[model samples]
Target chain A: MPFLDEVEAAIPALRRYAHALLRDRSAADDLVQDCLERALSRRILWRRQGDVKPWLFRILLNLCRDEHRRRAARPVLVPIDSVSEAGGSGGQEEFMNLREVHRAMGQLPEDQRAALLLVSLEGMSLGEAAQVLGIPDGTLASRLARARAALRRTTCRAPDRPDDVRGHRP
Target chain B: MTERKPIDDDLLVRLHHGTAAERAELEALAARDPDIRARLTDWQRQDAAIRALYGPVAEEPVPHRQLRLFDRPARRWPRVSRIAATIGLIALGAAGGWFAARLAQPPARGADLVAEALQTHATYSVEVAHPVEVPATDEAHMIRWLSKRLGHRIAPPDLRGFGFQLIGGRVVPSATGAAAVMMYEDDIGRRVTLFVTRESGQAETEFRYSGNGAARGFWWIEDGLGCAVVGDLPVDTLRAISVSAYHDLIDA
Candidate 1:
């Protein structure tokens, strides 16, 4: 496939991954935008590389790191109203359950969360996800286990208090 | 009849992410073990929740800004030339004052080398994948290749005493010529890099300190090559490591 077409095909997955990483809709799209721009500019260098999907993802991950660095001093704020903004299609109960999981996921350390999302959410093989995160397979496995245990604790412990996910709500 | 203990959490996580055979095995075990079945169901529910939360983003139409990148002219050279031309103009603008200072005294070339080293370190140190052109696993070949490219027999200074093991090295462009960077990471994943470039007829100089938040280093001219040790370490710790590297790489 032509490089551009191959990159285009990966856009949806890229958006999903970016969205999962950033947890904010516009910021996630902006990240995807930056990743695509960098990818386009480096088309020549990428031509010699294999597996455009992982490469594109690598670029996205790099940009994501840069974004975090640029905003290191500022905490990312995701407002409650915005959480319900992306709620058009799924059933209300399923959507609320997902929101609970999302809130629980937000509490995870970035490394562990990224590993879980890549393997569980993105359905990537462990090897591929390990490569994407730039960590060893053992490290990725440990992170997945930790993330799962943490999620079970947070999400499963209180099935009733959905709105109290953050615990700061008065 | 003996009851099989539910599989380990690590194995269960792997099974959730494993190949078809492993997944089938998970299913078989879950069929007989209620605990395993409950755990599997919990993970499945989590996956479903995640998919429900963000899967629609994938279904959304590709944003116009992204799709428009392809619509732009596919020619790369024009953009490259435009950037080059802008850089050329910027250099021309800076050269007037730069040359004026050169007439009064010799330019502090060490600073430029340090800046280049810092930039190289900043760019590649955070890389998780493809951190180096040659990985440390192929240490001999990397040494040979880097030495060939650098035009000198340069050794990656042994930093094991400081708990930083050589991860690998890459050849990067420098103001004077090609520069070689050797990256090392300690146990907790903090990285420090040694940047070296050969300069003919250059006089040896003392250490010069340069730093930004969480990244500090010192560069010097020793044995006719510009060398900088950079890391996001404390100034004192970086100094200790740099001093050790200077002796190992420059004096020896």
Candidate 2:
């Protein structure tokens, strides 16, 4: 019962991280569901003193990675127009920018995307993020740097120069 | 551009863990360096955007359906206990009957067919030297030997459509007297066995799915022959392979 209580307490944070990673409400919920199932099934393996949040997060990260691999193996062709917009401030320009951002996130390598989401979106400390990812701190830093650069190139353009942004070679 | 001071990576790392004095020094350095200022501002903006995107999700209500962690353990225990007891009794009866029947008939009817298939499959699948009693290269001999012992003409199921090759066949004693098992393998080293024996008068023709330990068994009987395919594959994939075997072997 105490373990269940601890898991319940962590659900909101898990949902937040999953939402950021997946960028879709339904997918985020599904990821949270999967994480809970895994945690429950493997409860005996969990150490009582170890942080439950990070353990839950590790399970979530693995599930996301597996889902990504499966989707990559059998790539689906989803039309860009059919992508449901997330809850955000609306304008045609803003919509286009958000869509471009989402596409760019997809193009990022898994490690970089994961690192960025953990540090920036989940508000995890660099060390905690590294631990969750099972990667060294240096690798996490490099991934975060690459993710930041990619986001800048994808999302922001000089207001006066649309063509310049499109034409600028990386 | 005038002489621009280089920003230290150590300074940035420290800034993430710095006191007020360290923060001021970093800010002063950023003020003096245009590139550092630009990079720092870009990093901050990206951080803000990411936070904005995901911050509200942390406050959203978590759906109750997703909270499997809260499932009552007490509720699950009784159901598991009931199933385990039922399976244990069935297994004991089957095993005792099988051993007794093994003396006179050498094999019984339905259960021995499944056991033989599983045993033959396990035995030959591991061998690097002599996997099959008769190799696929000698298909004619393999077919004749198995069909004669089984009391019916049978051929190895063609699984080319499923990306598998016929390995060979073997005759093994089953519950119904004698049974024949044919083996097949895919490129990924997955093996499937087709177990067939003569259907006894008491044997019923009904499809059944059972998981004995980690291995899964799918069985059905038709036309006086008992057939069961056993493997460790996922249920859907196992079902697909079993259906394919049925189609090919029955037609053959």
Candidate 3:
């Protein structure tokens, strides 16, 4: 496939990964913008020369790291109205069930949350996720395990689940 | 050599698959150790919750801004020309000033190097990815690659305790030779760059600050090595970061 087309195809996946990383939809897209522009500008630097998805994601992750660092330097003041604003993505009533899990995921530490988001949410293989994250496989696994434990404590609500055919909520 | 675990790889692989065979083996194992059931259940539930929370993002449309990155010509010569113009202007100033004040040599040269460092920072820091030619994921390779290229043993400071993570280092062409810039990001996405080059003429200068508009810089020289720590952070924070890095990288 041509490079741009391959990059285009990966857009949805990249959006998912960025959304998982940044939490806010618009901010996630901004990070994706930073990633794509960086990738486009540094095309010559891409030693691999093909399949820009992983490279695209690596940049996105690094940018997110910078953004996260910047966020840490300031006083955090989360708007209460932000939750209502997010309701437009999906109807609030329809997404009420998802909110619980989202809240739980937010409760996780940044590293562990990103680790979980990559493997499970993005459905990336452990190896690919680790490469995008620029971490070792062992470190990824430990992060996943820790994230899993954290999520299970805060999010597992079998009693609250709807009568879905599969035991899991989509 | 590292010690090997008793569990076979096949069984573990099966456990990941969650197949009937894997479940049976796991059940047997869980019978021996009850924690296995809890761990498995937790892993499964975590997977489901992540999917529930973030699955929709994949189905959403790609924002126009992200798609715009590819709209430009592949190799942007405009930026290159801009940098060249800036360099050209600097050269013109240096040539014009050489006859004016040869006695005030150190400050002018020092200012120029800081400008170079600041320009490099401004260019590369916006990069979401590929900020460093060598990603911090491969710290050893980054250090080794940078060290070899710079013709000096370079140990990137460990700044995790100060809430800064070393993203990696890269080699760039400098006036002297190839200079090394190690990039770091703190917890909130703010970045601080450490600019390093060999001390020319063995000019060992004292630690000093250079005001850079909204950004700030602190530079020092000791034992034929010079470093300038630059960032847009507030002065005190920048000083703290600079001092911490100096202790870990220079004094140590």
Candidate 4:
């Protein structure tokens, strides 16, 4: 496939991941367009045989980090609580609503959020996700573990259990 | 009693991010342990909820500005021609493979067609600003573009008699090939969609109803094309409109 077509095909996935990362539709799209414009302008530098998806993701991640740094003082956008009331009718009551999860995700450290999203949501393999984040696999694993533990703690807090549930292990 | 192994959160994290084979091994272990099983299910639900929240964005039409980047005159023509030639060769090879697969594969079932149509309807009908890629005022271009993409000549069915006006349409990717979706709206802003696609080598069938409660419609295959007309209208009204749409398509 032509380089442009491959890049084009990855746009939706990029947009989806960006939305998850930033939680702002227009900002996510702007980040995606920036990443794409950078990628396309430097197309000649890319090795055609190398995988394009991860390369695009790496660029997007860097842009997200920069965006976070630039907006460090501004309060982050959180999906409103009423959004939870709108969906998940019928048998879905057992599942945690998106708004709750989104709110929990807001509390996580940036590294944990990025690591969790790339692996859990995008379905990227551990090794590939590590590569995208420029981290060792072991570090990625711990970040993911911490992220999930934190999410569980926040979303389904059990007052009876000790606070050390996060540190407990086999 | 034997010492029971304490459930590990590390392994649970691995389960969420592991490869398919690794996931299978952990899942098997999860099956034998209730605590682990509950945690696994929770993590899975979290993943599902996250996808449910943001997944639809992936399927939305790529905005025109992003697509236009490829059309910019930044590249020299020589390299462009070389890339075009490579793409042509790839297309030729793919077409050959597709023809071979078509002979071996049966046409998709009616349920699959209707499911795809309803999915397209649910996704696009909610858009307030950019529902249709091409507006109805450019009906000729929209028709020509969709017809070329679908490999079948199609005209948007006139629903004016039923109090709906043609808004426009888009060509969405489908299991069979490209599917055309045209949107219509009554003056009150209730929207309806007609989803049409090519279903080669399929026999004609009567209208089949699918969906429920504010999002419902009918689908059928006729003359090698699978078409569904979906809306929130009453059952009798939807049936009448679908029947009209089917005749319009058949005649066109």
What TM-score against the true chain A does chain A of each candidate get?
Answer: 0.81, 0.74, 0.78, 0.82
After superposing candidate 2 on the true structure, give the runs of residues whose Cα lies further than 4 Å from its correct spot.
A78-85, A89-107, A157-170, B1-32, B74-252
Worst 10 residues of 2 chain A by lDDT: A161-170
Candidate 1 recovers what fraction of true contacts? Answer: 0.50
**True-structure RMSD, every candidate:** 14.9, 14.8, 15.6, 23.2
lDDT of residue A24 for candidate 2? 67
TM match of model 1 to true structure: 0.56
What's the CA error at residue B181 for candidate 2, in Å? 26
Please give, as one word, the docking class of candidate 3: acceptable
A best-first ranking of the candidates according to their DockQ comes to 1, 3, 2, 4
Best of the two (3, 4) by TM-score? 4
Which residue pairs in candidate 2 have backbone atoms (N, alpha carbon, C) closer than 3 angstroms, thus clashing? B107-B174, B107-B175, B108-B175, B108-B176, B109-B175, B109-B176
Share of reference contacts found in each model: 0.50, 0.35, 0.39, 0.46
Q: Better model by TM-score, 1 or 4? A: 1
Model 3 lDDT tens row, A19-65: 76667766777777767765654443344644678777776776677
What is candidate 4's lDDT per residue for A1-170, written digit by digit as tens? 55777788899999888877776667777989988986775453354476789989987887677567546769676453233322233344358766777778878887788888887778888889998888787677777877877887788742234432557232
lDDT of 3 by residue, B1-252 (tens): 012333322233234434467568767876775445545555565566556556666776677766666566534324444345345433533223333223434565576667778877887878996888888999989888878887667889877876889998898877767888999998899888898887656554545566545656767664456777888776656666776776556322
DockQ class, candidate 4:
incorrect
Query: For model 1, how does the per-residue alpha-carbon lDDT over B1-252 read when each residue is reduced to its tens digit?
Result: 113243556667677688899889889988987766766777777877777777778988998988988777445324344346345433433233234334434336866887788899899999999778899999999889888988777888889998999999999999888899999999999999899998767865545567655676767675467888999886556766876786567322
Name the TM-score of candidate 4: 0.53
Q: Which ten residues in a row have the lowest lDDT in candidate 1 chain A?
A: A161-170
Interface RMSD in angstroms for candidate 3:
9.8
- lDDT score of residue B27 within candidate 3: 72
